[model samples]
Target: MAALQKKQSINCKVLVLGKSGVGKSYILLQYTAPPQEIVQMPKLTTVGVDYKYGTEKIEDTEVKMSIWDTAGQEKYRPIIQTYFKNSKAAILVFDLTDKQSLQDVRYWLREVKLQCGKDVAKILVGNKCDLPHEQPDQALIQEYCEEFQMEYIESSALQKINIQEIFVKLAKKIYQQHKASIPQNQLKQNSLPANEAQNQNSTSSNKQISLKNSKPKQKKENDGCC
Candidate 1:
């Protein structure tokens, strides 16, 4: 994920929903903030909800996402819960080194379901994967996502591992989820020359907009495709 570039028409609200100390702030900072401006938060705890606006160039598609970094502690839940209604997608992060964090996925998933739009794209993220410790079992991760109806990925914000992917992949999912809302003219093939449009029409057109359509696939086995 690149830093915020010139604004684009493709936009959506992405809520970074997770527990405290799950590296949500660092993840957002690394993905969105430019090097010179990076501010290290000592406490690493959000008071309520923080907002960041940035553009990501994903497989040629430029997406301007309004990232809402929410406070994960119990007391601040109400203050941050309001934004769930407008959130187009969610990145539910958990501390990978903390097994208890994995168990808390249910509360966050249910919270999104209760407050977000019915079709909101939800992904469960396991942060700090680079740490040397007993990692989450692959089977358990799969089983959990199936029960919650969301996707999951392990990342280390400090190491910059899978930081960009977390957003790029989820952005793609959100793009596809709200595709019907996009104007016909913005669809790649529509803006092409007649000859080009004719050629593109012969192939799977949406694959052009959603880069992943041409690729293998992603994490959440049961979260369904993007």
Candidate 2:
């Protein structure tokens, strides 16, 4: 048998949007951190634009996720549009305990529509769900999701609630959408990783050893896109 090579990686860029101090950075921190590691989310705020990278397994394919975290402050708004181009999805985050953050997300949603295609995936994330507070208006949440084809999720980065699930959900959705364009022959041939050459007789061609919790080493990036 010919030496098998790893499946080609698909690059998917995702944009994270929300008001300042809404735990946008924290969520990304937890998502990239090792699953078993107890992460300490810092009191950090994005300035211009930042990038976080992680890989996920989508069936036999390996997906490289580039999460673009943009500054929510008004001064950085002018530069945010540059990162919006060709985004696979827009994650609109808000502090669940803060009504104002929830309201601001509507504006964020509008911003996404103006910059991205209608077909672009949008996810409404209510962060800081670990805190106690009055819920945002149910009607508004329903209306927001209805306005655009999107999914709603409540998460708490501090508590590591639903951090992993959100990325997996986004990756799977994006992969499905992109799958139609791939060449069938290429997909079939690259089903196995190069390191698995010893297991050439394995019948499950699409089975991949998941390294989801182990992220590749990368330097922290700010005011940049990856």
- Which has the greatest lDDT? 2
Tens-place lDDT digits, model 1, residues 94-192 = 887888877777688778778874577777888887887686767867876787566777888887899888887887776666566667767664446
| Model 2, span 1-226: residue lDDT tens | 6565546567988999998989999889898867666545567888999998988898877879899999988788889988888887878998877888888888778877888777676778889888997877888888988998777888999998999888887777777767766799655545545555446545344344334445698977888765
Q: Model 1 — TM-score against the truth? A: 0.72
- Error (Å) of candidate 1 at residue 138 is 3.3
Kindly state the number of residue pairs that clash in model 2. 1
Best by TM-score: 2
User: Could you tell me the lDDT of residue 12 within candidate 2?
Assistant: 81
Global CA lDDT computed for model 2: 0.81
Instruction: Please list the residue runs of candidate 2 whose C-alpha ends up more than 4 Å from where it truly belongs after superposition.
Output: 1-8, 35-39, 180-226
- The TM-scores, one per candidate, come to 0.72, 0.74
